[model samples]
Target chain A: MSDASQGASALTPEVKGIIGATAEKIEASFPWGIEREGLRIFTQAIMDPDPRYWDDEFAAKTKFGGIITPPIYCTYIGRRTRPGADDPITRAFEENPYSDGIQGVRTPETRGGLPNIPTPLVRTLNAGNEIEVRQYPKLGDRIFSQAKYADIKERVGKDGSRMLIVTTETVYTNQNDEVLCILRASSIRR
Target chain B: MTTAQELRDKKQTWWDDVDVGHEFPPLVIGPLTSTHLFRWSAAIENWHRIHYDQSFAVYHEGLPSVLGQGSWKQSILPRYLKDLCLPDGWPWKVSFQHRAMIVPGDTLTIWAKVTKKYQEEGLGFLDLDVGMRHYAETCPGRATIVLPIRNGKPIPYPFVPPKKLSEQTS
Candidate 1:
C-alpha cells in the first residue's frame, strides 16, 4: 500500500476524473467464436452436467435448439492473451511469484487493468457482482466487449483501514452489436 | 440426496411441475485442488495471485490457504440453476456476494430452492433462493429464471424480463 496517510484523497484527483471514461481500443473480443467444446469444458469444470452444454441430443430439443454458452461465459471472454510465446499464465509462474504477475492486456497501450484508476493503495479483493443478462452468447457467436470504470467509493474497513471500492461495468455484445450481457463487478482495494 | 449420476440423467424441469418450495438436485463441484483454481484462473485470464500462490495467499493475505476465485465460484451458479431449469428455461438475472473465502480441497454444494412461481404476460417465471457452501454458507444469492409452461413456447430467446418482475425484490 502506497501512502494511505492521505486518507480518502488517496483516490488522487487524477483517478477521480476518469470515472465513467471508457478505455479506448481496449477490445475484449473472442476470435474463436463460441464453440461446443468451450461450453462443455466450462460447465464440466464447474461440475454442472447441464445436458444443454454437453448432450447434443438433449440440447437439440431445448428452447435454445442446440448448445448455448453458459450465461457467465461472457464474463470470461473479456480478457485478451499476450502475443506470441510466453502466455500470461506461463509467465505468471515462471517469473517472480511475488510480482504483480503479467501486465493486463485489457489496455494494451496503457498500464494496468481498466486504466486511469491510480489509487494510492494496492491489494484488491473480489467483492462481488450484480449482473443483468440481456442474452446468452450462442455457439458460433463471436463476443465483443468494452469496459468502463462505473464508480469508485472509499470506505473504512472494520480494522479502520481505508479501502477503495471500485466498480467496473463491462458490456458484452455479439458480432451483430446485439447486447449479450452486462456485468457490474466490484472489488475492494485496501 | 442428489448424486452426480442422477443429475446427469435427470430431465429438465418445467415451470408447471415445479412447486414453490421445490428444491432441485444439489450440484457439487469440487474438493477443488490448486489445479482447479489454476485452470479456472487460466480460462478467465485472471492472474490474481491469491488464487494460485499459496505463499502469497497465506503469508501475504493472511488466508488459511490459497483461495478460490470468487469470479469462478460465482460463475458456476448459472450452470447449477440451468441444469435444474433447462430445455425450455433460461437462467436470467443473478446476483451474489463472495462474503467469505473458499480454500483448495474444499467441496462446494450449489443449491437453489424455488421460493415462488408466477405467470405474467403469458410466460412463466420462478424466483429461487440460491447459495453455495462447504461447511457453511459462503455465498448467499438469488436468481429469477424464466421457465416454459408445460408445452408453451420456449421462454423467449434473448429472454426479456417481464415488466412485472422489474421491481420485484430478491
Candidate 2:
C-alpha cells in the first residue's frame, strides 16, 4: 500500500471542480434493458427466496401486481455493453480473452464503466452504494439515467495511505421520464 | 411459533412485530463455489477476470483466491431488506460498503437488526443496521424500509416516498 501523498489538494482544483458536474453523456438503452429473463438470473443468483423475484404468479398478486424487477437493477442499468455498442471495454473483450482486469475501467467513468477522473490517483475501491427507490422497476419500462460527481473528499486510511473518496450519484428514470431511483455510489481512490 | 419464512411467504410482517433491536431472520447462502461466481458473471455479463479466472486472480493478481464479485456482495443486504417487505411494503433505501474480501467458499449470512421504527405519512418505517456476515461482517450498511401498520392501509403500490424524487436527488 504505497501512500502516494499528493496531500489533501490531490483533488487538483480541476478534479474538485468536476464534483457535482453531470457527466457529458446521458446513457440510455442499458445492456440488460431491465428485461424479465435477465432480472430473473440477476435476482435469483443470490437466492434471496423472495417470491416476488422468483414467482411470477406471486408477484402478480402483490401491490406491484405485474411483472416487476428488483430495484437493484438500477445500478447496472446504463452499462454500455449492449451486444455490440463498441465501448472501449467491450472492444477489449472482443479482441482478447486474457486482457487486463477491470481495474481502471470502473473508477470515474459515469457511463461505459470507463474511468473519467483526471488525476494521478488511480486505484479505486468500492466504497459503498446508497440507493433510494421511488419504485421497483417494472419489466418493459424503458430506462434512462443521468449521473454526476456528487462529492469528492480526501482522507487518510487506517494504514496512513491518503485516499480520495469520490461519490457519483445517478438518477434513473423511465422512458416516460418518471423518476425511479437515485443511487449514490462512493469509491475510495488512491 | 410463527416462523420468519412463514411471515415472508404470507407477506405478514406487521408494524407491531418490529422494535429497535429486533433481528431479521438471517438469509444464508453458500459455501459458494466457482460455478456460482461464473453463473453470476454470465447473468450480469460482467467479465472481470477476478470473479472467475482463478489462474489470473491467484497467480497473476496474487489474490488469495478468485474473489466474490463486489456487486454480488453489495446486493445481498439490499435484497434481504427488500424481501422483508414482501407483498405490500417497500424498501425505501439501502447503503453499504464492502469492508472485507470474500472468497468463493465463504458461506454468507445476510442479516439485519432493526434500529429504529416510526410512523410517517401514515406509513410504518423501519431503519436497520445490515450486513453480509461470513465469519466476520464483510459488508456493513444501513437500510430503511416501509411497511404497513398492523391493520392500517398497505404500503402504496410502486411506493410514494415521503419526499418527491426531485428532492431526493443528491
Candidate 3:
C-alpha cells in the first residue's frame, strides 16, 4: 500500500489510522422474528415470483420445513434496533430536517457498529459490495453484527481527481452466535 | 420425507444447463417512482433524504433529481441471480460497483452472463459478468454461482464454500 499508492494525493495519516480498527458487536433484534410482510414486499420490490417466497403450501413441503428467506436478506433487512431502543428514523428527522440522513453532520450511519472515519470528502456513494452468501437468518432471529475498516485508500480518477475509497467488512450472526454471512462493502467519498 | 438431493433439486438451476457464454433471463423493473424508493428505504431502514426528499436532493445536494438508494438498486441483482440458481443451488458470491446514480422514473434491467465454469467439492460453479442499467450500464460487476451438477448430490443447506478459491475467482 505504500509504494503503489504514493503517486496520488495519498491518504492522510489520520485517515490511514483507521485501517484495521474493528467495532464492538452491535446486537439488534427481529423481536417478532423476520416478518413475513417484510419478505413479501421485498420480493415484490424485486419482482421475484418464486413460490418459495410466496407459496405457503409449497414452502411447507421443502427441507427448510417452512418459508425461508431469499438469502440476500442477510444484508438488506437482517439488522434492526433492539426492543425498547431509540428509533433511528425518528432520531434522524428530528436531528436534521434537510440532512441527507445517511451521512449527516451530527451523525453518520455506521454499519454494524463500525466506528466512523472522519474524512474531508463531503459527499458519499455506495460503491458496491463483495459478499459471501452463507447461512440464512431465520424468522425470529436476533441479528448481531461486528464490523471493521478493512481498508481506506486514495485513488486518482481519470480526470486527475482524487477521492477516498472506504471498504468495510461486517459479519452477521444469529442470537446463538451462529454465523450467517460476511459482507465486504465499499463506498466512495468525494 | 425428502432426500437431501431431492430437496436440493426442488429449486435446482442445473450446472449441465449452462456454458461459459450462457445468459440468464434479465429482470426488468421500473420507470421507478418515489413511492417505490420510499417503501424500499423504509423497509431497509436507510432513512437517507436523497431517496425521498426532492427539494433537498435537487437544490442542496446538486443531484439530477431525487435519487434511489444504491442498496435498493443492489437488492435487485442478487434476487434475480438467486432465483436463476434456485431451490438447491446458491448465488454463492457476488460483487457490484454502483457507478451511476438511479433517479426516479429510470427503468432498471438487471443482467448476468456466464464467464467461467468449474467444479469443486463435487458441485458446479459458474462465474458471471453482470450489470444494472437504464440504457447505460450504471452498476457493473461479477458473481459466482454454485449449482447442482447432473445427477449430483445436494449443494448443502448452510452452503459451505470450498477452500479459498482465489481473489479473482469471482
Candidate 4:
C-alpha cells in the first residue's frame, strides 16, 4: 500500500467522528496561579534574562507596575501542582522518572491538541500559529486554557498526496475571566 | 511613583525615531541541546519523545535528529521583541509560520525589520518582518507592535489594541 492510500483509508469512520470535537480540558499551567519560581525557570530555560521577569523593583517602575511573564509563557505554564498520593500516574512517575515515563506524563492534549483521534497518518508537523495577546500574564495570575477544533479539512498535495489540516483555537484566560490571548494553531498530518 | 519620563529616558527609541526600513538588533539563542529541549518540555509537562529521544525520533519517526517544538521557537520571539521595545512600549500582535523545521544544536538568530510605521488612536504602530535563521532560514513571520511617542502617554499595560485600526491595519 502506498503512502497516499494508507493515509486515506486510515481515516476510519471512528476517527472521522472526532472532527469538530472539543479537546479535553487542559490548563496550560498548574491551577495554583503562575508562580515566581516557575517563571524564573522558564526565563532561564529559554535563555531570557529580562529583568522585567524577575526584578520586582525595576518592574514596579515599569508601566505594568509588577513583574510580568513573557507574552507566550502561558503556553508552558502547566506544571504538576502538589501531586496527590492517590493519583497512580503521578505517583508512579514520581517514584521512578524513567518508569513508563512517556506514558505517565503524556496527556491526550499533548499530541496535536486532540488526543488519540484515530488517523493512519504517521507524520505530523506543526504548521504554525497566529497569536493575539490582550494582556501579558503576571506572576500569581491563574492561567487556564480551553481548545476546540475550529476546522478540519483534507487536501491533496501537488504530488497527489493526501493530508489532514487540523486547526485548533485555544483561548487562555485568567481566574478573573479576563482573556490573555488566543492561539490559532494548525498542524499538518500526512 | 516613577514618572513615564524616567522610563522614556531609560530606553530612547520613540515613534519619531523609527523609519520604515529600520532593523532592531538581532537576538541569537541556542546551539541548543537535548538538555535545553528536556528542560523546556519538563517545564510544560510535555512528554513528547521526538523532542528528547534520539532513537525514537531518528529510527522510528524517520527524523534527522530530535526536533524542536514549535512552541519553543514561538516563545523565544517575544523575548527578542520585548527587549527591543523596552522602557516605553509593548509588542501588541504577532503572526508567524513554521516554514521549516529546526533540529537541536542549531543556533537560531532572530531578526526583525520594520516594513512600515504609522500612528493610530495615539499609539505608534510598527509593522515588522521577522524570522529565525541558522544555517538556513527556518521560521519566517510578521509582527505589529504599538509604541509610545516621546512625550506621549506610555503604552497602557494589560495592552488594549487600538479600537480603531483603520489607519494601521494591513
Better of 2 and 3 by TM-score: 2
What RMSD does model 1 have? 4.7
Top DockQ prediction, candidate number: 2
Q: Which ten residues in a row have the lowest lDDT in candidate 2 chain B?
A: B1-10
lDDT of 3 by residue, B1-170 (tens): 12223333545568998899998877778788998888887777666678888888888889998888877767777777776776677888788887877888888888899999999878899999999989688889898888888889788777777776744432
DockQ, candidate no. 1: 0.48
The per-residue C-alpha lDDT of model 1 at residue A76 equals 75
The regions of model 1 sitting more than 4 angstroms off are: A1-27, A36-40, A54-58, A80-97, A100-125, A149-166, A188-190, B1-10, B47-49, B53-62, B151-153, B163-170
| Model 3 stretches with alpha carbons more than 4 Å out | A1-18, A78-97, A100-112, A115-126, A152-165, A188-190, B1-11, B166-170
> How should the candidates be ordered by TM-score, best one leading?
2, 3, 4, 1
Which digits, one per residue and each the tens of the lDDT, describe model 2 over residues B61-163?
8999988888887666666777777656778888887788888888888888899998877888888899888889888888888877877876776567776
TM-score of 4: 0.77
Here, model 2's chain A TM-score works out at 0.71
Which residue pairs collide, candidate 3? A33-A140, A34-A140, B11-B86, B11-B87
lDDT at A14, model 2: 78
**Preferred candidate (DockQ higher): 1 or 3:** 1
lDDT of each: 0.73, 0.74, 0.74, 0.74
Clashing pairs in 4: A28-A78, A29-A77, A29-A78
Candidate 1 residue lDDT tens string, A50-83: 5566667766875567766778787775554645
Tens-place lDDT digits, model 2, residues A1-190 = 3324543456678777777778543546553456767777877676554566556776687677776766777667554355654465655656665675464333344443323777677888877889888887777777777778889998876756677899988778887777788889888888
